[model samples]
Target: MTLYYAPRTVSAAVAIALNEVGAPYETVKIDFASSDQTKPGYHKVNPKGRVPALITDRGVLTETSALLDYVAALYPKARLVPDDPFQAAQMRSVMTYLASTWHINHAMGGRGARWAYQQSSFDDLKSKVTENITANCRYFEDEVVQGPFVLGNQFTLADAYFYTVTTWLPSDGVDIADFPHLHAYQQRMQARASVQKAQSDGFF
Candidate 1:
């Protein structure tokens, strides 16, 4: 397998999952600093010109959630995902929220062109992006996270997904100290071997 990724981005979530699976693979860095991802060469790998595109035995798989799910499925013994149906559904819910709400809020700080083209609209979004992320984080820190992990004591795929999102907080103008539980959650994730490996691999 070959994984296309960008450092310090949500693409790291896929790297963390790949680390957990202990799979043999290669990484094709999509250097956003040089606009490499926007080039036609990369568009062939992911027509959307996004990172986190995985070359699998079957075909190329894009999207963070899909790549994570595919890795978990390919290596069931790694136990990246929960076995129980309800727990699995809860995991999906958390991932969906992070992708749909939390991530979008963070993106608003700099990528508002996705919604409106006006510079004023972009500035408006930048002003409130931090607050939006914090509010949604409050929901997750309180309403979700029932135990040590999202699925009680068991570590699920959601942990990797959520942890990756948390990485953007500090850069998103969020002082994680305001979210103690979430801060501790970040610490726990950082202590994991997989996360440590991702760090060493420069996935950050």
Candidate 2:
């Protein structure tokens, strides 16, 4: 398996999941700083031109949630997803929300061009990034984070997914310290070997 990723991005979550699964894979760095992801070479791997594209014997997989779940499915022993139907649904729900909402809020802090073409419009959107991310952080602090992880003691793919977004909060003008549960959750996540490995390898 080969994972295409960029540093300090959600792509690191896939690497962490692969580590958790004890999967050996090669890393292909797509340096977004140089616009590498937009090049034609990478388009062959992911037309969407995003990070966390996984190339396996079967095929290339894009999208953070898909690749994360794929790793979990490939190695069931990792138990990245729950076995019970309801629990599994809950896990997916959180991951989906992260992709659909939290991640979007994080992206607004920098990638405004993905949404707006006009420079003034892009600036307006970018200006709201910190506020939007703060709102999302408040939601997670008050409603989402359940316990030690997204699903209490169980560490699922959702935790990995959510952890990636929390990394953006400080830059998004969110005082993580204000959210006691989330702050503690971040500490616990940082202590995980998988996360530590991903951070070290990702140069973050």
C-alpha TM-score for every candidate? 0.96, 0.96
In the order shown, the candidates' Cα RMSDs to the true structure are 1.0, 1.1
Model-by-model lDDT, in order?
Answer: 0.88, 0.88
Cα deviation of 85, candidate 2, in Å:
0.9
Clashing pairs in 1: none
Q: Model 2: how far is 203 from its true place, Å? A: 5.3
| Per-residue lDDT of model 2, residues 1-204, tens digit only | 999998888888898899888999999999888999999999999999988899999999999999999999999998999899998999998889899987887787688889888888877887888788878778888888898889887889998888888887777888889888899999999999999998889625
Give per-residue CA lDDT, model 1, range 96-178, as digits (tens). 88888888889898789888989999999999987888898889788997767777898878888888888888878888889
Stretches of model 2 off by over 4 angstroms after superposition: none
Stretches off by above 4 angstroms in model 1 are none
Model 1 lDDT, residue 155, Cα: 81
